[model samples]
Target: MNEIKKVLITEEQLKARNAELGRQITEDFKGKDLLAICILRGSYIFFSDLTREIELPLEVAFMHAASYFDGTESSGKVNLPDQNMLSVEGKDVLLVEDIVDSGRTLAALKATLLKKGVNSLHIVTLLDKPDRRVVDIDVDYSGFVVPDEFVVGYGLDYDQRFRNLKYVGILKEEVYQ
Candidate 1:
């Protein structure tokens, strides 16, 4: 069993940030073909909220690339359950992710997307954890820069739990230990 240690980000904050990011993305990609690809399982909530806030005619897709297989630590191997589900050829791709931790998964995904002949590829993550980053990858838009704590909620999970929480929170240390 686990408990929320403290709230890292409130729901209101998330809503406001999403709206801001949406506006920025809308402005940047105005009059251009945009395909927002949601990195599945973890980023579905953020992608849904953020995409809805984007007042632009854009398409959406999903990709399941994960490095953490039911654990807090990254296994350093990206697992792509379905890779060829969408076509990104000659389209501006907006990769939506829940958190940018080790950067391994995103780097791999970015490379794969680029190889498929995308016009451009930009990353947008709900949370940015630079402290734990191993691969240097750029995040075009970031909602929050969090510390090196085990965070959960807002679609981020611990053992596939706590993802439905409305706000982001830190999980108790003992829970994962």
Candidate 2:
């Protein structure tokens, strides 16, 4: 992966697609009392832009859950927050994520929410990596479906290195070495 190709998704491309996603979300939850549940760390940037684009009245909540501890791999165990700031019981909950790789996190979160008596549950992800899927999860709205390669930037990362990259890129394997 040392041979770097050009940026896969430019900053302009990301902005345009994000705006489109925002418009769709705004239209879908027009009159309903929308509550956006954003996954922490990774999805914070995407959530910020998407929620702002949403014109309808809504509330925002955050949950910190992560499992990746090694290089390009997830621990496959999700840790829920001890003190959740937002209550979604009997409310329309839309879970927003930065990317869907293994999908274990979202699937687990959705199941927990359903068990807690959430009235409605929806999922929105900025990127989808179908090739790496280990658990079944449906994305109601997605901005892009990425290839099976290891990617970084636009909020995705490797040991938290490339989150600040404006454009998504296929990382050089040597970087990981």
Candidate 3:
């Protein structure tokens, strides 16, 4: 079993922040055609919590875009299967993500969504790790700016484990090493 080094963000903190983010989104997108897209696997928990908080009639969609394939480091190439089913044309899009690290996945998805004729695009992430970023990308709504560490929980995972934890925690280095 993998051990956690420390709890980085508590469950209470995440709940409070999610509520705040929802309010901000509701105000910004009042009466607008908003489409919240969840970057699958990692962002499922966060996407569900955040979308519920938004007090607006917005559409929700899911797309699978992966850069880290069961590893801590990104493979540098994003794998996006079929996104043709999503209707993004003339709609304000909010890409919901669990964390933003290397920025490659989000960057690629942003470009693809824009090409699909989205009226506007914005990103919302549960955690942001600027130190690990390899590409320039902007996160519109960020719950927390985390240090470059191997964190897992609340939809974040290591080899598809630890996503069930309610709060974010740093994984013990020995487990991964």
Candidate 4:
């Protein structure tokens, strides 16, 4: 079992940052057709909080795509289980994610959506780790820039535990190693 090593982001901090992001998004796409897509499982918490902040008429969708499975690092291959569930054609798409690391999953998803002919595409991530990116990806809106460490809580997980923690934290080294 892994204990939380340190509190990375407090609950109050998350709220403030997400609120800012929501306001910015609302202003940026004031009258545009916006379809916010949540990269599922990991992004559920962030997605819910963010969508509530945006004061605009928009639609919400979830895509269960993942590149990590019961491990500390990514598996390097993104899997989209419900690929045909939602259609994003001709919509201004905003991809909401829990974190952006390695950039493999987000890059693949962005390419897939672009091929579907989205009118515009933007990315919003609750956390970003620029040191781990393997592919070039642009994050339009980001909450925090984290160090190169395995973090958990706030929808990010390891074997799917600790997600209920209100704040973001660093996982104990013993847990993953």
The true-versus-predicted C-alpha distance at residue 66 of model 4, in Å, is 0.7
CA deviation > 4 Å runs, candidate 4: none
lDDT of 2: 0.83
Name the 10 consecutive residues with the lowest summed lDDT in model 2.
1-10
Q: How accurate locally is residue 70 in candidate 2, as Cα lDDT from 0 to 100?
A: 79
Predicted candidate 3 versus true structure: per-residue lDDT over 1-177, tens digit per residue: 349999999999999999999999999999899999999999999999999999999998999999988668899999999578798999999999999999999999999999999999999999999999999999999999999899999999988889999999999998788
What TM-score would candidate 2 get against the native? Answer: 0.92
Candidate 2 stretches greater than 4 Å from native: 1-5, 82-85
Q: Can you list the residue pairs that collide in candidate 1?
A: none
Q: Rate the local accuracy (lDDT) of all candidates.
A: 0.94, 0.83, 0.94, 0.93
Residue-wise lDDT of candidate 2 within 43-102, one digit each (tens)? 888888888888888988888877676777778888777334557788888999988999
lDDT preference between candidates 1 and 4, better one: 1
* Residues 1-177, model 1: lDDT tens digits: 249899999999999999999999999999989999999899999999999999999999999989988668999999887778779999999999999999999999988888899999999999999999999999999999999999999999999999999999999998899
Evaluated at residue 126, the lDDT of candidate 1 is: 100
Model 2 misses residue 157 by how many Å?
1.8
lDDT of 3 at 173: 92
Choose 3 or 4, whichever is better by lDDT.
Answer: 3
